[model samples]
Target: MKKIQLFIFAILLSSTSVFAQSDATKKADKHFAKFQFVDAIEAYNKLIEKGEGNAYIYSRLAEANYNIFSTVESEKWYAKAIEAGASEPEMLFKYSEMLKANGKYEASNVQMDKFASMRPADDRAVMYKANPEYLSKILDKGKKFNVQSLDLNSNMSDFGGTLQDGKLYITSSRNASRKNYGWNEEPFLDIYEYTVAEDGSYQAENLLDGKINTKYHEGIVSFTPDGKTMFFSRESFFENIYEKDSVSNTKYSVLHLFKAKKGSNGFSEVEALPINSQNYSIKNPTISQDGSIIYFASDMPGGFGKFDIYKATLDANGNVGTPVNMGQKVNTEGQEMFPYVSSNNTLYFSSTGHLGLGGMDVFYTKEIDGKLAPIRNVGIPINSNGDDFAFRMNEETGEGFVSSNREGGKGSDDIYAIKKLQPLCDVLIVGTVLDEKTGKPVSGALTTLVDANGNVLASKPANTDGKVEYIVECDTPTELKVTMEGYESNKVAVKGSNEEEVAVTVNLKPIEEIITPEQVVLNPIYFDFDKSNITARAAFELDNLVQVMNKYPDMVIQATSHTDFRGSKQYNQGLSERRAQTTIQYVISKGIDASRISASGRGETEPAVDCKPCTDQEHELNRRSQFFITSGGPKK
Candidate 1:
């Protein structure tokens, strides 16, 4: 009877151990779901230490690490899972994605093909094959940005450094050699400061002692342009969905923007910004030059991308306006965070969605008339194929700071400063001028420069190398027009305020002219894909052609339209004909002699550029309307 009791007790103990292990796993999974990867990793580590780990647990660990942008660790665990006999398609897909992200395109393609063959009907495989912006191909030609590790010494990770009041205010995850109650053990982050010396090195120090440095994750500190108010992100304790506790008030990550004003006794007590509260995580808050607009990164709903950057306007009464997502162009499927608006109104931020070298790279885009231009990769030195974040630029000098965990770094992550080195005005514009039909460089092409208006500024012929170099004042925006005889003119507009010089390669399409009995003059009109209506620019070109036709009153021409192979053959043929007729009608309406003009539609049958199974852009060569001269007679 005693032996039986001992056996029953052993079974009960085993059951209890299993239940504890399962609970730990559930808690880890909850943290993982909420993107609390650091916490999830710790939990998973504990489970593994208890020998309760399986291939599934390792895979989850790998995924969590990958989510936290820990590529090397993620790859290590992924390989372990594969070795553990995990043959799931998701595992293979994720491994391939990792390989592709790391620039192993051929190997990644092998895995991708295996994944595709295993699941032949999967749409992702087909999409990967047909995707123009292939992740592998783009990363292969990735430009190397210069990211040098600085020699600044701080006890903790120095990140999110901004320049204000002749001092560099930065955020650090360091504790000032004291035990503070606000110190959060779960991935603690905090704010710090440093003074910039003449030697361009930071004399780093902690800020507010332990006052502003919360126990939880706090990062990305920004001060208003006037240097009066300061804002930063704070993670707070709150109930999370994945956790089982009903009244779970334990510290979880939440982004709160705080405000503080400078006072005689250092700074006033930091207060939470009005819009920030117990709900939702917000980080990387940046104020506009005028302090009217506040931009920050958030995981809040209504964003187009994950952890998208949102902008809120502060009214005259200091009331925060509705938060608006920066839109798909600025944001992407990946996180867009750590925004810094330069004094010149250029918006600089970090993004993972755009084609970058790796991880989160710093990008800058100019805001013109409230619309953001395409985000431009800061490129080399400022950005690398690593997790580059928290970019702050000094308006007085074109120098800036970025945080990175790249190779040769002092620690897990370090703050690095980049000096423009090159003079702001010393910018080069280098590109090739190609013949639209042959795809060959055209030398001696006359490229003219103009201001934002149509006023001509400078004219230079393309050199023997088929490149044009123009030096202009970098204070104003400029437009470039490339022209050569017997080809369509090309124009590229570049804003010159912050950018040194604009480099653009122009492709000039051949002007097709038909010499016939009647005098005819017709202009080639370009359209976007699958669209019948003429664009405003195309209309402008057509107007120029109309003026030419009017100058030669007796000249008549035929408007010919064509299409690339995209839609059904019959559909393309009809669409092309309709497009040709539409052009003819538009010309006639412009007071051109109807009897002098004719229209014809020739679909994919006549392709100017024979790119079989071409890309959308290459197919555009077939989708165009041209003018064939029917006759050249005396002026009416």
Candidate 2:
């Protein structure tokens, strides 16, 4: 549900008397704006039955339905409103969002484009214009985590988890002993405890015996590093506190912050923070690593959106400072909640305002050089079209937990264990290009960094100083390729690590020298045992030979293939012949005339490096291929 939209709609509720053209319209408009969807629908449909419906009435009906997540009803009335000549930009915008929520992406995009055309300056339209393919990009972010739903999830809602001393504390609405919360028709939320296993699974489940579990709705919880202090959320009603609405007969109990200290008799010293208010809900508390800061989400005054993340200074004396909104960098016009601060000062929160795959996606912002980096969505399956939030991470093991109401959960909302695929490392690669012959620096050489999958991660030209620098992931294997005009391309393999910066020098040899070398020596052309077919890697080296021969058409060459010492002379001769023939046919396939290329099998007759006791490396070198210029090529 878009609660911010609901808040604004509630203000429009007052306009019912002004817009009251008739008795039926006044009652319908008031109910619709006041969030009484069933009453609003009944009132509006009564007027419609009398043929009194118009664009305004249909739009209001659609908005009221939308407030309750009635996508089908919302879509129908929105279409009716449009057909009745309602074409406001905001109308179109809401229609597009409704379509998107129903997974009608293509149709939604069409309406989005129309809305953008009308309100070109709107931020939502601008974001759509800038990155229409954002969904695929998010999908292409690939798996950053492996998530598993906890088996301890109950039949009702179970969410918001944290681990301390091998014990997992989770918020759940599964207590049969408590009264059902009217909001969701589920039992009131309580803090359930489970002992975590060595395999990261949990066992020995029970309700927290401490004063933490309550009768009202409890949300998220966290503890300090030393485990001496704990911070958690509970509804103000649990403290016998609330503000009663006279007309609506609603008791609005805002969430409050509470602190407790550990004692030998379990958690005992429990008290509410000074920041609790009867007017606004302040919840989802997470503490900083050093216990100096307490970060939480609130719907208080002076915020950027419906709910904003705020940080309060926690001094040694237990005094809480004024709450400060995180501002535009993390907050937006939509809800941003569940602020978690890592040891490195990285902030993790859930936001509906930011562009995401859908719903509230978990995002993180880290500071670099006194500036906040771009907030990155943690990506799915940690995220989904359904509400996914309440994220906390253990940076040491690269494992943590997130709660989502996505499909396949044992409950309406289940806590998921997530482990990061890779560690975050700040490793830089400094590349140097030089001439192999003269050892002189070669400037402007093109450099490319490729991962093991052969995907190009980055590309740049070496500076005037023959240096090209690119950042890489630590403990990740990478290959650096360098090339320059009139020089043979060279590649070097390296891994970025925590200890030091990786330096690589690509020695570019002149093209002429690589085409015809004095020794006719290169990396061995490997053959699998008794197999003559060329592998992909072997074919790559053969392509280089084809390039040289193609440049000099009249070149005549001889190919000699050998066998290792394991095979008998007679068996080796027959096996090596097939490889020799295969080599000749490969060159012929590259447009070299069959008569210009000849091949022979050496069997075990010639040994480049003789060894009475040969190692695998030596045997591999022995089972090789040698190319020799017979005539009309670079002179020997």
lDDT of 1 by residue, 1-636 (tens): 000010010011111121223455888766654445578788888888999877767777777666544666777777777777666665676566566457666666677777767766554454455443444434443443334556663544556667788677765555555333221222355566778788766675646654566454456777766787777766544122111234333334455677677777656677777676454656788888888899988777777545788899976545578888888768765568888887777788887656455566777776642445545566655665457788877666766778875656665567887666543332345556888778888898888766654556557788777787765544546666776665656777765554455678788776444223442333447766677776655665676567557666767787788998888889889889988887888889899878988988897788888886798777866777777666774423
Across 1-636, the per-residue lDDT of candidate 2 in tens digits comes to 322232221133321232235666877655653456667787898899999988778877777766544567888898898898778776776677667666677787899899889977665676678668767867776777899887888788888778887888888878898886533346777887788888867888788764887666666678888887778887787787776656554455678899888888667678999999877888889989898889998889899767889999989866789998887778875678888887767788988767676556788876543445556677777887656788888887878888876667787677888888854444667888999999988999888787775656767788788888776545658888876766666789989667357788889887567555422344567777889988644564565567667666777788899988887889998888899999888878878889888999998779776875789888887899888877776655
Q: In candidate 2, where is summed lDDT lowest over 10 consecutive residues?
A: 7-16
- Local distance difference test values of all predictions, in order: 0.64, 0.74
- Which regions of candidate 2 deviate over 4 angstroms? 1-98, 114-125, 239-241, 423-636
Relative to the unseen true structure, what is the Cα RMSD of model 1? 13.6
Candidate 1: residue 398 Cα off by (Å)? 1.8
Tell me model 1's lDDT, rounded to 2 decimals: 0.64
Error of 1 at 267 (Å): 1.3
